[model samples]
Every structure is written in C-alpha cells, then in structure tokens.
Target: MADRRARIVLVTLSDSFSSTIEAMAQDAALAIDRWTPEGDQSWPDATAAVWLLAGGEETAALDLLAELPTNGASVFVIGSSTDHRVAAALLKGGASDYFALPGDADVVRRTLDRLVQQEGERQAADSFADAERGSVGFASVIGESAAIRRVVEQAKRVARHDNVTILIEGETGTGKEVLARAIHYHGPRAAGPFVEVNCTAIPDNLIESELFGHERGSFTGAIAAKQGLFELAHGGTLLLDEIGHLPIELQAKLLRALETREIRRVGGTKTRAVDVRVMAATHVRLAQAVARGEFREDLFYRLNVVSLRVPPLRDREGDVELLAGRFVSDLATRHGLPTPALSPEVLSALRGHPWPGNVRELRNAIERALVLSPPGTLELEQLWLERDDIPAGDRAHSLLPFPAPLENIIRAAVAAMVELTRGNKSEAARMLGISRPRLQRWLSEDTNEPTDQ
Candidate 1:
C-alpha cells in the first residue's frame, strides 16, 4: 500500500523564504511542488492545488488572491508581522486562510489540517447524489394533539412534491424551524440542502446579497465572491425565518425570483436558474401586513401557497404535559442520568399557566430547571412562574352574578368546562354529567348567565 500524500504549491520571489515555506510544509507531512518566478509562466497549468503564497504588497497579494480558482482550495500567506492587514485583504479576496509565516508551527499545521479536512468534506458533499428521497430522516417534532396532528398531516401531504412554497404561521417560541427541517427531510428535495436564512437578523443593506448571492467586486467591501441562500439551497428548501421584517424593496426582488425561478448575482451579468422550495415563517400577522400595504400583496400570495398554522402551546391542549415529560427524559438522557419524575405540583403549575412564549419557552424552562437542579425529580421551584402570573382563579365569567347556591355552582362548573374546552358542548356536558341538549340550552341562554371579567 502506498502512503497517501497531499499536494501544495509554494510561491515566493525569495529563495530563502520559499525554501523555509517548503520545508515547513514538508514538516507538516504535505508534499510541495514549488513554482519559481520563471515557472510561473505556466500558471494556468497549476490548476489542482492548495497554494502557499509569500506576502508582497497588499494590492499585489489581493490581486493574486483574486486570480486564484474559486473551487475548494486555500491560500496561506506569510511575511511581515503587519501581515494581519494582508490577511484581511486576502480574506476579502476569497482566501480560505491568511497567516504571517515563521510564527507558530503547531497553529499553522492545524490550519493546514483544517483546510484539508474542509476540502474532504466539500468533496464528499459534492459527490452525494441529488436524489429527492436519498434518506428519510426526521427532526425532533413531537406532538399528538388534534391541532398539532392536523398540522403534521398537512406537512406530510405537502412534502410529497417539490417547489411548493409553504407559509408557517406561529406565535414566537414555537419551533417553526424544527417543522421546516422535518418537511425538508421528508420532502422530494431531501437529499439537497436545507438552508436557513433569518431575514430579520440580516441588515437591510446586506439582505439582497445574502439571499441572492454576490459576484466578486460586487460592492466596495465585497472583495470576494459569495454564494447566497438560494444558490446553496438549489434543489432543496430555503427557510426564510422572520420574513415579515424583510424590506419592501427586497420583497419585490424575492417575489420576482419566486415567479421566474432564477436570480442574477449582485453585479454579475449572468442569471442562474435555481430550484428551491421557499418555506417562510413569521410571528407577525402577514395578512394584516398586506392589508396595511406594508407587505406586497403579490408576494404574499406567492409565499402563502399553503399555510400551516402551528398551534401555540396554550392552545395545544394536553401537549404541555407530553412535551414537559419528553423534555425531561431527553435532558436526562443527554446528561447520562436516570429520567426524573415530574411532581403533581409541577405538572399542575405548568398546565395551569399560559405559556406566552409557547413551546420554545417551555423547553428553555425545562432545560434551565434540569441544569440548575440535581438529577432527582424536577421540582416546582425549579420552574420559573410567578404565583400571581398563573391563571389559577382569573377567568372571564358572565356579568350577571349567580346566587351562591348548589344550582349556581353546577352551572358555573359546566360553563367553566365549556370555556376551558373552547365551546365544545359535548365535552362540557361530559365533564358535568349532563346531556348535550341541556348544556346547549345553558350556553344558549346567556341572558341569565353571570357576567364577570
């Protein structure tokens, strides 16, 4: 068996500097092919390579970096200690790494090692076949409530096709990204990429290039070429999170791309065709935005091809208990300990309180509790809900006060059950041991009902 060797291209005008670089590279177990000043005449032939260029003037180093190939290869520059500026220029010029030579052997060796590892990973990623159903993997999206189950059913139905835009509407703290990943992994473009771009986090000035990509020298600071979400997510899914915050101008361009299935890089003459399913999510009400003329109506229609509303934790009946238990068990397993029990008081507190932050908040609370408390049962004190905040006794009641009697108590219980279950008369009747028609009559006769807020 032959030893696997790595190829390196060392370039420097000075022989001593070039020799030092070549020796250092060889010491790191990489084979070098030095390109002298005269041999540079055939620079075009030096195609397959990882370059190690000795530093020159900042402008010259940047020019050299720009001329290098765009494929997965790195450039390591060495020279004066002030080469930090040169390194910055190189990075802006699309160099994978920049370093001042004759410094730390261990750190330089690690940098080279990382470059080789990244190259290997990129090659492996490229070699993967772009089959729609290459693998069936699902993220941690667990829920069985009727509301959540219906949403999951809709997701499964939509995942069968590719390029169908989906709008996921949910309150903040709901796992919109988790559901998005689940859709992508199970969809026709599963083998492709699942790229996420947070529209709100990106600055207004940079949103365009971030979403659609940019060509080299596209702007003053854009010294290197950059691939945006749409290009990287080709044949896959692009999750535009917090999309409601996108500027009106960028929204117009996004709508155009959605309609045309192509995007022109920021300063490039050529338009590239892409096949990506756009799944956008927002805590804000997009319909209201359209009505207010804040969001474009055409773009709204384009993105809202299919809407899946993720139920908030408060509305997702019985899911709190299920999710809390699941989180506890998951946290226990992750910590390599026995699954702890949730006390009745803790369950009561969790169920009784309205989770304004939804499932996300719940997970955070649980994780915080687990981390703070020892491995025993998670206690009520570990959870952070103020006693006053719990909706223990504050519920809306009819204004007409009921007499403090047995009949009134029964009516209150039945009415409370009906309100708690969101006007499900049958469930109210079952809870009160009364017939459906009786409960219906009770609800219909709001005239005699007590009114108290």
Candidate 2:
C-alpha cells in the first residue's frame, strides 16, 4: 500500500462498479490493484490511495469497517443499497463518502480521476524550529528602522516553518525580492535552489506552460518536454515576483497547486507531487484588484498566510544617509574609483530628498554621483537625484503623460511639486502659482493616497 502509485483496492461484489473502474483503468493506463480480504485480511497495509468497500452483507461490512483504522490516511468510499442503518454505521465509522451504486458512479469516477492526476501530499508534520541556514543569510538586508527591523524579525520567525506560504507586499523598489531571498537562505532549504519568476515579464499565452511545464509535442512549439519554474524550484523556493499580474485564468490552478502540493503537466494525463516553498511578492494592492474583478479572492487568502510589508525609503527615517554612504563606498570600490566623502551639505540634500523608487533608486543615484564626481571628491552638483527632482517650471511638461485626464495631469503636477519642495506645501504652491487652500484641495483629492492631506 506504500507503493506510491495511484491504485484502488476493492472489497465489493458490485460487478457494475468494478467493470466501470476496469474500463477506466484500461483506457487511462492506470494501475488498478485488487487485494483479497483476509479472514485474516489485515487492514490494507492502509497506505493505499483509496479503499472501495461494498456492504455485501451489512453485518460483515460494518464489523470489518469497525476493525479497520479509517483515519484520513486513505479515502474510503462505500456503496450501500442495503440497510439504511448499516450505511449510517459505515459513515460514522470513518467512511468519507456513502453513495448508491451506478447512479453515483460518476462521483466515484471523478474522485479516481483526481487521484490519478495528482498524488497525495506527503508533507512532514514534525517541527523544523532548529532549521539549518546557508553560508549567506539576512546580513544583506541592511536597515535600522523599526519598520524594516520588524519585517526582518517576522521573516526569521517564519523561516523555521519552511512549508508555510508567504506574501510580501511593498512598493516597486522596496526590496521585496531581497527579503524573499533572506527567508530562503535562512531556512532549512538553504542548500536547495532559489528560483524566481516575474509573472509580468512572461507573455500571457505562455505563462501556463512556463509555470506548470509541458509534455513533448503538447503544443505548436513544444517540441521537447520542459519543466516549469515550479518544478525547477523543487526542494527549494519559488518567488513569484509581481504576482498580482498573474493571469486570472491561472489563479484557480495556482490555488489548487498550493493546497494540494501537486501539479500536472500541460498535456500529461497524470499529476505529480512537488515540494517547493512558495512566496508571492507584489507591489499592487490585490484587494483593489479583487474588487475590480481582476484577481481571485480565494487565491488572495491562500497566499496571505504571512504578510510582510517593506517600508518605502521615504518612511525609514535615518536609512537614507546610511544607505547612500554604503552604496557610494561599495560602488566606488567595485568600479576602482577612490572613495569620496559625502560632505555635510551633500548629506543634508540626500537626507532631505524623497526617494520615490526606494533603495534601488538610491543605489543608482550613488553610482551615478560617484561616476560623475572627481576621483576623490563628491559634491551635490554631481548628484542629480532624479529627473523628477527638477523644479516645476523647468520639467513641468516632461512629467505629464498628456492624452491623460486633466485631473491626472493636475495630480502629477501636485505630486511633483510636493516632492520638489520636500512636502513644503507653501513653497510648492508658490512655485506652481496656486493658493495654499487650492494646493490642499488638490492633495486631498488624490485617490491613491487620501492620507497625503
């Protein structure tokens, strides 16, 4: 019974049900094993995929069922047309399902089909509280704010329970991927591979085959069988980056895979078991998407077991100076340039500016500044920060996407002015030729951030 294949053993005299199953097995090339009931017939090694019991004699069936341990280790289906009392007894004695023969044969067939497609999930229930870590770990997540520190501590706590799914939420450049890597390397699955798939980057038509693989000749271009990112990540982690962009059609399949720990090849007839810790990272607000009818609610709850939000760079108080210094030193060293000092004025400017793109943009700014500055000196002039940093009159036209709604253009202008003035609405209004009350009205109307007021 521990044979690890989809096989059903029967203890019934229903020729119709057995014949139907036999025909299905032959057509589908499935393994159908029949074991003789022992007067000494011990409980099916009890490791079989399914046990089909028929109450030929109600008393004998009830007695046999009582003697067997029908805990959820196996699926038990009993067909009873005999005593209603006997049927009740079987169900109470751990029979998962009770159905009359032939009429309910379709249900029986469907259950077998699902079993044949995917194996039972075989996850270890033992605790992994003392999981081992890889050589490289969380040291890469550099930050001192309580915002980021709390995220790191939460990650470390869940790292020990490697099988739990995680949802990482943040703005585009807020280091969601970096946090995902930290979770994987610090857990027991450190030695296994770490695979990443950007759901947005893949074409919509090919994403299914890309995530769930395909059999040879399954489609026009599938000349050879290929394993998907999920299978490639077996025994390790699979980070579905930009997960909110995953197609709506595939959302249900994804939910089933997560729940069952199994997946089927694109054109294959059977399902296969997989052991991969899944992590979904998204910058999009999935709840809003669900409201828009673009994402599935069930799938959202499935992946939301542990949510960790990475704070935007603007929110992490003193991290800008530290991060900029580290980036400058590291980038300079990597490019073989002398390490330059960030003067007091330059540091003040760096700290005062808002980093819309978070740490990624900060790193790029430091590298650009290092490359533009003289070998041993860094000045504020050498750091452009970003093109958006230009004043309203100088870069106003460049910010608008045009063809956009008048409100949208106004919104962008207001946001740019706010960033340009470092949240100084008075100065921003003066530059934009708008009154203080008007600026407040514009900020209040911002839908994405009502709290900006």
Candidate 3:
C-alpha cells in the first residue's frame, strides 16, 4: 500500500468505475480525488492520475489527457482486456503505464512508489546543482590545503545563520568573494539572490546613492526611481567588496542602516525596511585603518560580527601546483589545445616563486604558458619568473647601479614597491613611509616625465 500522503486522481465516466478505484485508493491509504472526461475541471494536485476507459471511450480519454496538465506526475490507463490495442496506443500518447480492467492493487502501489522516489531523487540532484551554480566562479571552492580548509569550514559554520554580518579579510585575489558566495548559496537563504558591489569602484559622489537608491528627480541624473542593492538583496545576501574604501561620511549612514535594518533613498523622505544579510571583504585591515582614523570604529565592530580570513596563495603550501595544473587543464580544454605536462623544473619554479598576486596571478601565468608553449612538456623558461617582466624602461632603472641618478633611483624604488604590493597603492604607500596622496603625486610626476632615450 502506498503512503497516505501520496495523492491519486481517478478519472472515469461511470459511478461504478469511480467507486471501484476509490475503494482501491482507500485500501492503499492514498488520498483520492475524482474527475470526469465530459466535465471542465481544474487538474487535481496529485502524484498520479488513474484514467478508467470504457468501450469506445479511448478517443475521448486521449483528448482529455492531452489537455490535462500532468505537472511532471505520471498518468496510468485502465481499459478493457479486449482493447489491448487501444491501451498500447494510450501508452504511446504519454501514459506511463496501462493496466487491464480489474487492476491489481499491489501493482499500482509499486508503480506509484517508484515514481515518487524517482521524483524526489531528481529534485535533490537539481537543488545541489543549483547551489554549485550560484557560488562564485559557478563552482565549488577547490583546495585541500589546511589554511583554505579552515577558512572554508568557518564559512560553512557561518552559513548556518541567516543574517549574521560577516567580514572576510585577505589580500587581493584571495577568493574572498568565492567564500562569500559559498556561504550565501549554502545558507538558509539559498533560494535567494546573491548581490555584490565593489565599494572602491563607485565614485564617491555616487556611492551613497548606489547603496541607498534614489527617488525620481533625486539628483541631476535621477530621472526615474531606482531600487538599491540592499533592497534588491532583500531576503538574500549582499557582499560589499573593498569595504574599507567606503567614505567615512557614508559609513555612518551604512551603520545606521545596519542597526535599524532600514534605508532612506537619496533625497527621499521615506525610509524602507530591508532584510539582507551583509558581508564585507577588504584587503586592508580595518583595525589599522581605525587606529589611523581612516575607518569608523562603530561600523568596523558592526561588520566584524563574524570574521573569516581567506589565506593568501603563498601560505597555502602545495596548493600552487594543484591550482596551476587545474588552470592549465581548464584553459587547454576550453581552447581546444592539448594539455601539457608540467616538468619537475616547472613545478619547482612554481613552488619556489613568491606569488604576490596569489591565485589570480598563478592562473594568468598558467594560461600564458599554455598559449605560448608548444605540444610538449612545459619547461621552467616558459614560466617567465623574472623581475624584469616589468616595463623595459622600468627594468633599466631597477638594474642601474647605486651611483645612478637619485631621480632614476626614486622612480625605480616606487615601481619596485608597487610590484611588491601587487599594484596596491595603499600598501605601497605604507611600505614606502609616505601618505597615499604623496605616493599618487610621485606616480603622476614620474608618468608625466619623458623617458630617457
């Protein structure tokens, strides 16, 4: 007997036919609903439909079955034993299975149970595939290194909660967004959208309006009302990348929004509530920025409710070779090129090199080697691991002796500092013992000056 929770809809032309099926349905402990071919009625919400056909009624039953919305459920047919040909035709016309009149209860129950189990398995597979698709890079986080595993485990733990604010700190290209997506897609709000915005990319004047939205005629460019990221992310998660770059004035407004779970659009008097889980990622340390009076203390505490740090590639030992091989294989397959084997020298060079740009840089390097290397094992020379990979002019300045001109030396030092920090101006300034504005000025001056022939 099938479970009582399983529903069966009996479609027949005569009362006797309905009564017989209804009795069988009751014996199987299944919920039963009735419908007739001549009547115009809505489709029943059932797991399977049992259609009873009388002599010469097969044509009408087939027409009705064509109009019925099965909704992924199975449809079984019951017909006279003499009309085996008609029953076979019904099977061709989308019926799952056909039984002669006086159907066996055990046979029907077994068929329904099998269909239910198959549907459940199919739905579970789809849900898992959707979760994987929703994550960053549209795939699961890859890496077996202890450092990455710890970060991933912590993210999974944080994912159990719906609205806890999370702070992910790591150097640039450390897969902060990947971890954020994993948490959001695996969390309680897995069905919801995952919205992300780079705080550092938006202009200062527009950042506030971008986060909080704007009403019609709110500003010079506001011709129509628009919803903000927070509103769009309602019932989901919002990731703020490079959050440390958010202006101090707007930080207070963000803090208020977080505190009250509400935001007022730019130039709008009304405030609206939002149900978004906030996650922030930054390469800069907010604690240091707070001590330096660059970031707000209160907002820092608000976002740091649960801190998870993504380990840089350098610290995740042996992960380089794994990631490099993966990138090579992926790129080769994508481009229809034959996958090249990594020689011992190439592997040693990959392991020994300090990956300043981390995983992102490693991927780029692998991609370059795949395109440039021929149909054989990739060698160390093809890896391009020299400091002189910088601009030809900059290389000349860096290789110059100590007696070189002070101006050349300064420019060379700035270039070296920028490279060391993976082109991060803020970190370069900190390492050079100068303010960011001063460092920018120096770069501007250097760029404006003509290169010596």
Candidate 4:
C-alpha cells in the first residue's frame, strides 16, 4: 500500500492550469505527477494522496475518476459545469470534492486542511485497534453452562474464518458484544482492529455517513472527506450492535457492502475495498422484523450466514450462582472492596430469582451490594434485588412458588413424600406411584451427599 500522503496526481488538459497545480504541490512540499490521459486509461504504479480531474466530458471524467488509482487517496473534480446534477453525478461516482472552478478554489483549500485534521483521528483509531488485539478472547466470555458452552464452541469454530459473516441473536445484556469481541480477538484477525458500532445510537440521517463516510461537500454540512466505520475497521472485525435497528433504506447498501466487500462513500463516485469481517448482533428477533417488513429479507439472509443465539440467564440452569460469584469477585476488586464470603442465603436468592435483565442485571446488583455493604461485609439486604429476591422454601414458608420449574416441583413433592414416610423409600415410592429405583435416581440427581443415599 502506498503512503496516501506521498504526492498529488494531476489529470488535466490545460497546460497553464497544470503548471499552477504543480506550483501548489511544490508549496505543500509534495511531488506532482501530471498526465494528459492521451487516450490511455492506465495509471498503474502511481501513488498519490489526491488526484485533480479537470476539463473532461462528464462521462469521460466520471469514468476516469472511477479508474483512478486509490491507495486511500482523495479525488477532487474541478470544472466550469454549473449543472447541479453534474456535480451530484461526479460526487456519486466517488469524487472526494467537486469544485465548480474557479470560484470554489477556497473551499478546495479548506477541504485539504480538514483532511489533515482528520488524519490525527484516523491514526488514533488505528492505534486503539492495535492495542485491543490479544486483550480479549473466549476467556473473557466466562461461562460454564452447557447452553453458553455450546455457543462458545460454535463461536470458536467460526472465529478462524474471519471472512464469514455471523449473526448473533440474544436478549439485551446477554453479553452479545462480549462474544463477538471474543471471537474477533481470538480469531485469525486478532492482530487487526475490533470495532463496534451501535446501529441505534446514531441518528437515522447520519448513520449512512457514519458507516460509509462522505465526499467533501457531498451534503450540506459535509465540508470534508470523512472515512466511515467500514474504512476504519478495514482488515478487522466490525460488530454492528443492535443491527435490527438499522434503517430499512440503508439495509440494501449494507447488503451490497457485505456481498462485495466494497463500500462507496456517501455522495462519492468510487467504491473503496475493505477487508473486514462483519458481525451483526441484535436483541430483536430479525425474522420477526423481516416478517413485519421492517427489515429486509435479503439483508437478513446475508447477515444470517452463520447464526448463533445466546441463551438468556433463566434458561441457563446452574449458571446463576457461578455468574453471581464471578461478578461479586470482579466487582468487589474493581470497587476496592474486600471480598466477602458468598453466603448460602445469597446463592439461594440469586439462583431462584429470574434475571430478566440477564447477566448484566446480576452484575449490577452485585455492584450495588458491594457499594451498600460495609467495608468487609455483603449482607442480603444490601443486595436489594427482586421484590421477593429470596426463595420461599427457606423453612419459613417452605412453599415452592407457583410457575416454578417442573423439576423443582417434582423434587419438592418427592422430598415431602419421603419425609411423610419417615425415610421409607419403598413406601414413599408406592405413595408417589413410582418405582423405588426411580425415586433413588431422582434423589441422586438432586445430590450425592450421604443423606440423600
């Protein structure tokens, strides 16, 4: 890749204009390569940060601009045409700036200065990406439940295939981005950037520019050429979070970019090649969105190349306690609080509460507890979770709540029956209308403690 800041290329028919352009390049301490085109369309081995297109027919100028060598170079089209459509067409063809010379010369100068200002952000973004490499992976998405393990297994398998588009579907706060990051940071492109953008966060009008940049003066306020997220995330992973919120109008463009690995800047005439792996994640079910005509079917299909659904917290049996403990440990350390023993009451309360907000809510509750607790203690009251965060069957009521898991109801019944029979397994089985061996098996599934046997 040529350094885009190296020099300027002039494609012009006016000798005087070319000489003046050469003088400006000299003023900027940049080398200039002038060409008359001469019916030849090739400019191979040319490296320039900016190209000047002057004095050509509309079709020819657009074609020439489209074929111009691009190593992240900006193109400026200058001519006397006052037709608004001509400038629009040139910009749509990827001209970074269309100056209706000779009155727009000052605007062009300002655009160049703006490009210089943007270079600083570009460098910082790239450096940030480099720093993120190797800082996260599958380990960061900590979970041992079979449900989570299954998702992790699939993510790991597909992580190496960075070119394959992936769709991650899950509820909010289910750590969808964490999984996406783990896949990217541990994948073959770990050395590349890991960029994430929330589709809903940007306004509808500006999202197009945010994702696909814009040519200078392409729109009313587009004073300078700007690189979009796709350009910034080149050669890495770009996670479009909450993708279902992406506007239907722009979905076609997204699909095209995904299908072609190329994106044209907003109001630009040329397509820029981007080598990036895309991961689209949404809390809203996209199929439902498609059915509602809110999301494009083709775009959904394109993004759903490899779909993975992260299970919600309630469905992930036996993971609540594990996650709660982990959150306590992590949050405590971060808040500079001493780690307190996770009491059986706290564990029981955590396991029984259905986490509607999922892992994120659990973590927040733990953080709240840590803050509300004394320097070395984590009391149940400080947790202040669900209205009835504590389970009912804690010797006071000992009544399993309604709509409890069938298995828990079954266990409660069996335990009650065995106690009613005074530990007589055979009698209890007969009363429950089940075989003694089955009763014993259920008990064993419940626990391996000596008392269960």
- How good is model 3 by TM-score? 0.61
Please report the candidate that would top TM-score against the real structure: 4
Worst 10 residues of 1 by lDDT: 129-138
How do the predictions measure up, each by TM-score? 0.60, 0.60, 0.61, 0.68
Clashes of 1: 9
Tens digit per residue, CA lDDT, model 1, 1-453: 743445677666334356666666676666566554445454433223455455444466566655654243345555544545555566656554455555544555665564455445434554553432333233366777798888888888998878789999998878788788788888777767778887866779998999987754579986445567887787778999988989998898999899999887786645667889999999889999999988999999999999998889888888999999999998888987668889889899999989877887787668767876877767677676653343644543532246677666656666766664456577556544357776766655556554332
Off by over 4 Å in 1: 1-139, 387-453
Q: What Cα-based lDDT does every candidate model obtain?
A: 0.71, 0.73, 0.74, 0.77
Model 3 Cα lDDT, one tens digit per residue, 209-290:
8899875446897644456888767777899999999999999999999999998878665566788999999999999999
Cα-lDDT of candidate 4? 0.77
At residue 376, candidate 1 shows an lDDT of 71
lDDT of 1 at 69: 44
TM-score of 1: 0.60
What does candidate 4's lDDT look like per residue over 1-453, in tens digits? 745444566777444345555555565555566556675655534344555556445567787775666666667776767788988887777776677666676776665455444554555656765776545567777778899999999999999897999999999878899899889877888766778999976889999999998876679988767789998788788999989999999999999999999999887767888999999999999999999999999999999999999999998988888888788888888988898888899888888888877887777668767887897678887665543543555333435545798987787777755654457788667655467776886776566324443
User: In model 2, which residue pairs have backbone atoms overlapping below 3 Å?
Assistant: 38-41, 117-271
The order by descending lDDT is 4, 3, 2, 1
Error of 1 at 236 (Å): 1.2
